[model samples]
Target: MHELIVSPFLDGYLALRPGHQAGLRLPEHRYRELQAAARTEVPLPTWFAEIAQETWGLDIDGGSARSTLLVREPSDHGFSRASWEINLGCNFACKHCYLGLKEFSGLPWDDKVRLLDIMQAVGVVWFQITGGEPTIDKHFQDAYRYAYSLGMMLTISTNASRLWQKSLLEMFEECPAYRLVVSVYGATEESFDGLTQRRGAWKSFKKGVDAAREAKLPVRLNLIVTEDSADEVDAMVALAERWELDHHVYTNMTPTIYGGPESLLAQSSKHLRERTPFQGCNAGHTFFHADPHGKVSICKVGRDDQIDLMAEGAEGLRKLGGIADKLMLRTGGCQGCQLSGSCLVCRPLAKQFQEAKAPLANYCQHGQQK
Candidate 1:
């Protein structure tokens, strides 16, 4: 069957099969043209009609084809999209890595599948498979296939060092990911290896990108800007452009999700936010994060308030939502703070400081000066 999937973050829609076997990206203007035509009983746009025909072999002008078309919008429930840290293990230990290294085995294959089932049942249509590196998981292929079979749009976040592997590349070729968000640390071998702390990771990363391109897989680059890699930002962007890939630049660094100090050293004072308005976050309302061990929380940063996903199943989601809502509630201190206009602190981070009864000197510039 063919369906129109609308992303809350993007203004357009994608026409995709239930199994995600084939799809077409429809820009906002084109999507609007189709919608307007549908409402006014005008003929479908030539581009969309051609794409639909090519991608799904559906002739929109045909009555039978019209009956088979479906439109799916983002879930109005607590969260429409969710991310899973498939495993916390990694081959490269980047200095700025957020999760930090931990010794722990991930849930069993069956358990991971069960979690995917639960997520699907709860109206989570888009799933982001991430980790220290998701491909490092032994059962990543199995879990990924299971999610794909369940008709979920999957996005894989990786450093791209392992994408050259025959097995991993094959899995991606068979069940294509909705997108591969690859993290590029630097442009040159010296700079890249310096940030990743892996002697030959730069070569592997380049090979992985080449392999993905050779296989015609969709890839997006995320330029991680840190103190060590700042000099290569332009080069990294140039590399992405050379590969004809879309990219985003990230400069903010946070303490490890586990609340460690390692990530603090990697922070760039120039990139730190001096002031941010209190517009609230989408954590509990429309997004959540699941760690490798099945601990579900509202977001990656505020991971302390969590519930066991395997133990509670869907009920765990409810508890998580409640916890997030409660944590987001404004406190007396936040309400009366003089820096409310320019304070970069959010309720969740503020809650972390309150719990520790210590100032988050690394995060808050104004508070630190005070």
Candidate 2:
């Protein structure tokens, strides 16, 4: 099994290992040498081996290193990261989920591999696998293995419902992920199960958490503070500390991806915080998100003008730049709003709130009365 990967990063090259945080920054010449070693019978440079051992305890001087150590061909595709919804299916019935329907559908295995190939071809380096809950996807393991094989660093966002499964844990043990980010709904079973609308969810979540901890897997928690779980926010944070895992607090809930206001009802009015000003981002130019069917969009928040990766392949991404530009323009609802310069929400997000017909105070500054 390969212990290290060399790939083009944002405007540079990085030598990294799966599941490990430390990395070696490679100059262009060093990256080229690794590429050459991969192509020919040349042995890995002593410097590379020493650094690999120092950083990850991996000995690359072994003869197989030339072949096993992945060295990706360079691409100037201008895209470095993407998040894919393995499937919209979930084992849990979290009420606040932004995917309104939570349909359990996705591309067949062959098509899923094709989509991953297209993503790898376009130099997607950092890949995130998500879902209504992703672990349950039939092809998730195969797709995850394939992405890692193609030198993509993977991050998996899930509810920690399936981490206790032996097969999944073994796969993660063999091919580690960049990180497994689990969502923390509540500190108590009554609050958690009630919020997920599922009985016995807290037990399953606790099992998954224990399994992950036992395996020493890198995990982070997202404390989801909705009205049901609002009172236990501190306890939720303590739970993360108890596990000695990193945690992030999420209080602001947005409308569903389909622009439905159902998810907003779960929002805790007391925990609403002012969003940082929109300073813009490289949504399409350098980052994108893919649906289970391989349709690519600029980002999750703005899903218009999707490009079909299956039908059009890597070349399909060309349209994303233009689509991103169009989506970011201060038109539509904010066409001429004098307050838009400091408006917290982006134009696309504002459009969703408008479609949901949410309260005047929900998304607008005037709603501060709530």
Candidate 3:
């Protein structure tokens, strides 16, 4: 296993370890020096050895760190992060699911490997593997292993339904994830199973949670508050505390991927928090999203003018900054809104609310007017 991953991050270079949040920033010249050392199998720099020893207690000494260090080649592209949906298939049918059609289709093994390679070529150092439920995908193990072998720090967004499996636990132990973001539906079996529409799902989730805690895996809980689960928010927080993990509460609901308003009905209006003003992001500029079939988009919510990664490869990413710009513009119902400057939602998200024919108050400042 590699002890450190050296790669180009944002504007400079970074050296980070798997499952560790702290990282060392490397200057451009030093990064090039490390690249040369990696190519020639020379001993690592004394400063690097000292820092590694001081930081992570690694005993690199004056020996060649090349054997245990993964140094990625710098790319012409500025992309440093990406998210890939491994599959849309999931075990539970939750009411607030953003994906209306949770089909289980994904790339074949060969294509999956190729896509990972393409992402690597574009300097994707921070990678996230997500799905309607990634742990249940048949090819998830192979895909995750290959991605880890490439030395990209990994994060998985899962529902925790399969974390209890011995095979998965062992695999996760071998290749530690940076984090496992698990979504929690309800606090108890009765409410949980009822909300997911899957009998015994709550039991499975509890067992999985117990097993994960036993294994000491880095886990975080996402409390998805719906009308049904709203009353159990405190219980959910208490569960996270008992498990000794961090948790985030989400009360807002989004439209389904196909612009259907059904998911919005699950929103707990009483618990809805005010959204911060819309600020620009680095979605397509520094990071992008790829669907299971390799179609690339600006972000998860903004999916227009997708670039087919399987067809264009990494070179196609050059078109994304332009696509992101186009999507940022205020069009549709938003073009005429005078409150656009202070609108809480961005263009892509507002468009969804419009398509759903949601009441303006649900998303726009115009509706909040007296």
Candidate 4:
């Protein structure tokens, strides 16, 4: 039987109401406000019961209820949080993009509206807009306004080229929850333009970053390391400091499951520069991805007939719990790999291991942990 539990914040809200009635205190009233509307009245016990029921969508009893006493579920602010890889169209022909095809094809604006509507219905408060470049979307301005109307906190990842217009930055003045993340491929135009293969993109990106900063907007600097630019990490970090921005940098590997892993490997840095920590992975627990097709998968790389992401919604992540156990228990190529600490585990890597029946070679031989 599946277990059920109440979120701590939801429980706290339930406890705050009168024993006989469920109510929420209004910020202005300074008194309890009844949960009853003209049509429906909710009692404290039943209100808590409904929330628990919604969380797991399962029948819960005293045994499950008692377990809640041992722990408090994380607070549920009731803000729907979602991230979208909006479109595949891009200005740069970057070498590392795992999705090889570059085209303007994307879900129509109407479909996105349906998605936003679904998020609002679920009380999602946060939304992340990602893409080939969100700024380049012809309908982005409209999409942003629609999401803001529904009370969503927005985060966007872009190359930061198209948003260089001061007018564009000004449009965000009323939108406070919006934060822009600009991916800096290189520290200088010489390094950056060479990698992006787009002339003047460096200048355009800097102007956009400066414009956003001038508007008093929060900004983050994101960078991906490739074999060609692996040596530039220090320079990139220094640039981030100069700009007074938060920095995120990671090495790239073509996802093994995706057919384009070869393409990604060609674009990524062959030399390993750093080692990531070895920990039991929490795939479905930490984060998940919903593709344009509306199908969810374990991690972004696990696209298969068995991983039905559409059915799970946010709670579907639970289906993938203890995945590390399955990988560890398997007596296959992944069984005795020395780079276990550095392996990018998932169905893709697992398939690679199974097919080759050998450990996937690490590009940076010298960089391997001894």
Candidate 5:
């Protein structure tokens, strides 16, 4: 018989079969006692015990049940979702783009398919396809079709400019993406072109959005807020409302992973001032990010630390487990800081400070308060 254990942070439950690692989601409120029980090798609370038996069909009282609960560690290559940046080439060059003027030597078409296979093999069900513009990839259709055939639930983050193309729209109509996230730069031509620095981009974007709606595709909008586009925030939201599409607004921005100076200039001071608790990042654990060149990392902002997925493949995932574990463990100036409740600094960005890179003016609030 297999044993069940709760995650140390109570984020989820882990099932320990002899050779396989599976995760189970449980209510957040029950995490404390469940984590304690799993650590001490004691019986689960009555509620979880019943849930395990009924939902997963596991016999809790079998003679082979292990005395010690096997808690799944972060280094254990177990994850259910991932974001793949197909390529770093975008048509529009937004000033506030996090990846500032970066270039990537993308993998060959065959390698892209292989990476998709590895993602499926690793139990990644929810696959998000993102890029400078995913639809612009030369082999975008081939890769999208292959992943769709594998029965993966796919979502795409795109600018929506090329979505109106016949070939791409046909593919979406056939495979039907789980969601289409259209990034809205501005509500009008002047505001849009001002941020993107591309002539006629606003017209192209609106055309693509209209085409997606006509195709009956699942679509949402991401209203990107920057100092240059702040005046258009209300108009952007109204645009989404007119289209009857759900929308989210992103205000905060960060510098490039390599610490580029251009990014510092683009960031908004007011947006960075908003404070939030250090609720811990889930990157490299529950989720992972892969760039165009097959370099995998915990997340885009923390891309400085990475593994070459092409050279190492799944083994690279195992190596990432240790890095993620260390990242989650609070150390250095962050240790025992009372302002942790309001501090926005995370481990990956904190690493930037230790390496003597200039800190974001907003992140300096921590030191200022101390």
Candidate 6:
């Protein structure tokens, strides 16, 4: 038992175990199943089976139960949802950003309608709009207005660079139902500009933050931690306190930039190695991101197109929940993992990649997980 406990695989997992993940211990059998599943052109079936065998010691009855579970079951009345990279456009070029340097061109009127209709049909009570930065798009106000019209909780994920504009400030005031989530890369201008690589972004960001506070809009602040700026955490906390805003500081993961892995290894913090396997991550269950390309994924981190939303619509979107169900059964190296709550496990890895790669590392306590 000590040997098993000492093994790095199960290190953090022993503390807080998930319901489906506890007590199951067929490592060899699960390994074989996972291997077989990996070889298949489409491994969703094998993935489902692997999870069932590990979690319940029971078969999934040929994936039918899993499929039905994903589609028919409405866990929390479809309360939360999100859309990602609507246009691949962002004004700021943050080194730690996953979308990386993509600019947002306004979505065509038809596509915008399709997205709105999807939200209305899905009964998604809460939704987030994100991109390289959703506010950078010229029609960002339109996006907010459309979502607000549906009488749903709306949130925006942005760098807060553009919100300094007076026009944007007025629009935010009109929409009290909306929340603004700003990402602060560091505690000071020098630290922040170093990450964003923009000369005056720090000032613009502060102005935007002030605008949101003055407008009385609900705002959540995100701090992306990197090797360069990690020491500023206490300062960031102080800033959050001073501003009276809810804050989170997350480890940086390589941004999924189209160009290359420029900061993947460089910017990652010492905390990355200390992190234990993820546990209790309910991304798909709590919130999901559907990209403009119609790929339904758990978050921007584990973005994938295997579960195509365009083909299946709301039903397809719900299929992502199946992926989450399967991940709960993944426990061998990950069970009782401590760092589980420290990172965001985007569902696409369990659904498609199956490689146990770290989820969104940039997320701190507030973005998701505890």
User: What's model 4's lDDT at 170?
Assistant: 55
**Model 4, range 32-130, lDDT digits (tens) per residue?**
222221113222334445654554343433233233221112323232245666676889877666556667766677877766665555444446777
Q: Which whole-number lDDT from 0 to 100 does residue 260 have in model 5? A: 56
Answer with 5 or 6, whichever has the higher TM-score.
5
Off by over 4 Å in 5: 1-76, 268-273, 329-342, 351-361, 367-370
Rate residue 76 of model 5 by lDDT.
Answer: 39
Weakest lDDT window of 10 consecutive positions for candidate 3: 361-370
Query: For model 6, what is the alpha-carbon lDDT of residue 333?
Result: 45
Better of 3 and 6 by lDDT: 3
Better of 3 and 5 by lDDT: 3
Which candidate gets the maximum lDDT versus the true structure?
Answer: 3
Error of 5 at 341 (Å): 6.1
Q: Please give each candidate's TM-score.
A: 0.78, 0.97, 0.97, 0.66, 0.74, 0.64
Each model's lDDT comes to 0.73, 0.88, 0.89, 0.55, 0.71, 0.58
State how far residue 31 of model 5 sits from its true place (Å).
25
lDDT of 6 by residue, 1-370 (tens): 0001000022111110111223323344443443344345333455545655665565543543322221111223253456655666766776766554565554576677677677656656456787767776666678777766554456778888777688777766665444678888888889888888888888988988887788776788886778657788789889999999988877746535342455564365564633343566555665677665656676665553346666666667666667766645535444564654544443333322223233444332222444
Ordered by TM-score, highest first, the candidates read 3, 2, 1, 5, 4, 6
Per-residue lDDT tens digits of candidate 5, residues 150-192? 5456789999998888988888877667788899988889878
What digit string (tens of lDDT, one per residue) describes model 2 on residues 1-370?
Answer: 6778898888999998989988888999999888888877677788888888788887766555467578877776778899999999898888788889999999998899898888888888899999989988888888888998888889999889889999989999999999999998999999999899989999999999999999999898999999999899999999999889999999988899899999999999899887767778899999999998889999998999999888988988988999999998888767788878877788788888888888756666756654
Q: Comparing 1 and 3 by TM-score, which wins?
A: 3
Worst 10 residues of 4 by lDDT: 13-22
Model 5 TM-score, 2 decimals: 0.74
Task: Give the lDDT ranking, best first.
Answer: 3, 2, 1, 5, 6, 4
Q: What TM-score does model 3 achieve against the real structure?
A: 0.97
